[model samples]
Target chain A: MNFLSRLFGKKNIMTDITIIGTGNMARGLAARAIAGGNSVQILAHGDKAKADALAAEFTGQVSTGVLGDAVTGSIVIPAVYFDAAKEIVARYGDGLDGKVYVDITNPVDFSTFEGLSVPAGSSAAEELQKATGAKVVKAFNTTFAATLGEGQVAGQKLDVLVAGDDEAAVAAVAAFASAAGLTPIVVGPLRRARQLEQTGFLNILLSANEQLPQFQWNSALSFVPAA
Target chain B: MNFLSRLFGKKNIMTDITIIGTGNMARGLAARAIAGGNSVQILAHGDKAKADALAAEFTGQVSTGVLGDAVTGSIVIPAVYFDAAKEIVARYGDGLDGKVYVDITNPVDFSTFEGLSVPAGSSAAEELQKATGAKVVKAFNTTFAATLGEGQVAGQKLDVLVAGDDEAAVAAVAAFASAAGLTPIVVGPLRRARQLEQTGFLNILLSANEQLPQFQWNSALSFVPAA
Candidate 1:
């Protein structure tokens, strides 16, 4: 059966995911969405061709459109950089109300990688939540794009550390993650995004260190329970 | 054999560890030091009785002294709070030069538990390194006091993430951690301490979270490698 046929043939669709941007994260998340049996909508910021190319790569129930178009999915993932994610959130405004906005951007000051770009005590996810009425959930920030494509690091399942204030919003994201064959560890409320962002920054630092070859970008930040 | 006899009777002492502070972390680290067969010295800021009491618990080659007194061990662990640690370092001055200083304080702002108390581009360990000429190493910040006492979380060995600019200093700290029955994952240079401190803050936030019962004070910030 074709990807579209499989998507539409389902009696009850779990959730439709709208991914913004045409970058690696956008592609990675889109792949996971398709694998999880969810319809995906790819939105390009300015270049429609880029979105079209990304959409063409997948045969599932996927569509492409410009950024300003109406979002058609219950879960909107702004898989863009931190600044672009902010702009998308602001532009969506009240249209995103009640929507689960999945924020995967790590607001790291890449110039130094010594600290994050967000203000003290705040995170990109929390700031995005403030800019819009959408229930912003922090997920996939720690999962490198390359690793996300494989859907697992090493042999263990990818652990998606999720944090958000709204229980239903967090649950919605968690449901999608579980369906994608990832372990969803719901850390705490939305405020926990602060640490989640820091953890992402720490992981990035480890990946960039030339001395620690084993901690390349592909390593997973896992919570191994005692045997 | 008694703790002291075992500590000094050996041809070579594994490591002489001097821990400052009478708090839970002090006791926890002292317990690990004794368990690792290292001679320990307990230093109290104002209360000699507290240090004496902690020393009395360990029948090893343990001693007690005030903060300004000469540090007796080759490796000194500042197990006090962040501010107190800074003060202790300043008071010790050049006396700490050439010594291996282990910084276990997580410079967190408990007011919000949202960010660190240190500056944007720095950490408690880095700041301590700058204050004194001692080779400062970041360790045990991610390990909770309770977990340090047990040396493991959920049966898995505690992963002690170490960061220091000096290679030998980092190795010394790593050796102590290994002898104490913990896995020492040396992350990178001293700058990596920034991320380490942030990770500590993040872990603290999770522990303080009321909703996440599983992430109590005893939980660990672990990096589970692929099986």
Candidate 2:
């Protein structure tokens, strides 16, 4: 059951997702993706040991190497920094011609954490989408890495608010989210990624609040229907 | 059921809720407060005609006056711009020795809309509280005026998140919110107003998103409690 099989009218399509980093966010997402029953691979930029450790830790169908190694999957997810996203995509031997690129990094100026690193009107995901000609979709930028790793918060599984213009690609992502034990709330088109980034920034501000400075990373966005 | 009646054992302490400004927000909040059974008043800064029209439109309960009039009974809520919040409060008077001052304005630099206009590491409500010794509490900043006017969306009543150092003050504001037909969500302490302001900013960003632009001012923040 591989991606190729599913694409050819076959019942089995085990979507293989390859993450390009071994950092906290990358490892967290890789673990979740692995837990969701998808084939996961780890690409260590320099530290091969760290990547191998992550692969072993999650019991994932993971492999380790430099970015140029054949990614062997249809959906090659780069779970790294914004600057690294394009670089890693460039490292792939065959460009993402028919792949759905998902950008989750919040290109925020962490030194300030008060504002974004991008221009006044633009966002990180939009920039990355343009940088790599891959069909980029913005998702998983609002939730924290801790919550992403843990999945359940205060016992209730968290919700992932996703937005992207591609309906079919978004459907694939929503399925992936469900596999990760998250309730995926599809908000709107890709540009709404700005909302996700801004909301992520606001959540960061909330985490800095003195009164509730210690807010658990478990909190999430939910839609409560009117009674 | 009046403020004094609920307080000093009089069973007759009338809550004189006066809003300064004849803008849509002021009109909307005043209408909700009046519906909540408070003795509401409207003090027009300069547009007495609009104030009178709104007062007449809602009912005789909301009277109009100049900005400096002493708003007797209950709490005196300052519904104005963050920069103007302090100025309006000063114009109205600083002798708010024992009254609860509800600050619903989010400190947004509308000219930029990139972030807040106030000092970094703080929020509009916090700044207002520091400026006035009127036991300030933050509430209603999370919802749009239109949503507040509508009271609910998709059958779900909207939530008004309140935060303040004073528990009693927060509770009082919560009472007012409940009276207005919205759900009051007490999100920890007053210092959390910083977070509330940030949340408001993010919601504005959501509205600014092109694809789902104006996806109904009906949308609101709903909590997903841990199961």
Candidate 3:
């Protein structure tokens, strides 16, 4: 895409985004997607009440029964667990084909939060790319869920680092991020997920109270010129 | 230590630091420590000639013999290889005791720069802390070695992330970083080394040639207010 096209891609932009998962991050991103001037739908497994509640809260639609409905949108956001992603794709099937699938799950082994659940030398995003055969793009895995709820900070906005081997899919997610009032930092390729996970680890270390007595959770990475 | 002492400890400001590695990172930090007004030294083994050559080019001192002579000052910096640290520590022995030891090395298995050397639950800095009695402090492991040498970019000094259980040691390294014309960001306690290493991994991901194309090697992390 041209620089101007990429920059103003979201201008007067109205797109369809389907959020898969009923968890906090899914809810949060769904709300932001609405705020970003897009149609959003939440898909949860046998949890229509929670989905309905989020829909009511965010003024978006909710899909509790059919996975196909959730994957029908132009941008299908699988904001669910990593292990659950394969099942999600299996259920959604070819409905996800030809759509920009955004995988925002951390895929971290929550029991340890030390290593990844994916096999050594492999990435969860890459696995999802292989499983679904959909255009998979990685984004929204860096920021804290609470930060996503707040979205903008200090009158500026948070940056969403997006990575994917697919150029057109990456561009689509970048537009979605911009529509949500965020600056999308497109990292190199899908393999860059390894680094994205590492960045998340760094942020967690800096923010988590168990690590340091005086460290606050508010600090973030910003780009500036040489001092 | 009191909050103010922890914030800007005066005692460590006067501590002399001798870096024991002559790699790019070692050279970068050595330059900074010298700028910080601390007595800086470089110790290189096997390749003492290369170390000496770098020291001469940078106008610093290089040591090949005894660790005692190299670490006579208040701070001893082990900037060598991950596997080589134990040997260096064994050689240093009593010389490392009662001194603030700064660890700027990442256990990144360069063989597969895509992954870490140590297992998920451990960190190189922590391992150094355990093996050596020299109150260990983890710093300057988050950024690229090139960025470290350059010090600042786009009119802003790069921030050095430091983590360790020892407040005094961390503060000392922070002072050294500041003096070298870089910002010292004390990112919590020692366990946060995991985060810093992960940050390094993220940086690598951003720079991976096959990944996100916009992630230039020169690009780095900086922060500004929410606005």
DockQ of each candidate's interface versus the true one? 0.43, 0.26, 0.36
lDDT of 2 by residue, A13-60 (tens): 334786777877787788788889887767788877887887778774
Maximum-lDDT candidate:
1
Which should have the higher lDDT, number 1 or number 2? Answer: 1
What lDDT score is found at residue A193 in candidate 1?
81
TM-score pick, better of 1 and 2: 1
lDDT of 3 by residue, B183-211 (tens): 77787778778767767666665566554
User: lDDT values of the candidates?
Assistant: 0.83, 0.69, 0.69
User: What shift in Å separates residue A52 of candidate 1 from its native position after superposition?
Assistant: 6.1
On the 0 to 100 scale, the lDDT of residue A179 in model 2 is 91
- Comparing 2 with 3 on TM-score, the higher-scoring candidate is 3
- Provide the lDDT at A21 for model 1: 91
Instruction: Name the candidate, 1 or 3, with the larger TM-score value.
Output: 1
What candidate 2 gets wrong by more than 4 Å, as runs, is A1-16, A19-138, A141-219, A223-227, B1-16, B59-61
* TM-score quality measure for candidate 1: 0.82
Candidates 1 and 2 compared: the better one by DockQ is: 1
What is the TM-score of each predicted model, taking all chains together? 0.82, 0.64, 0.72
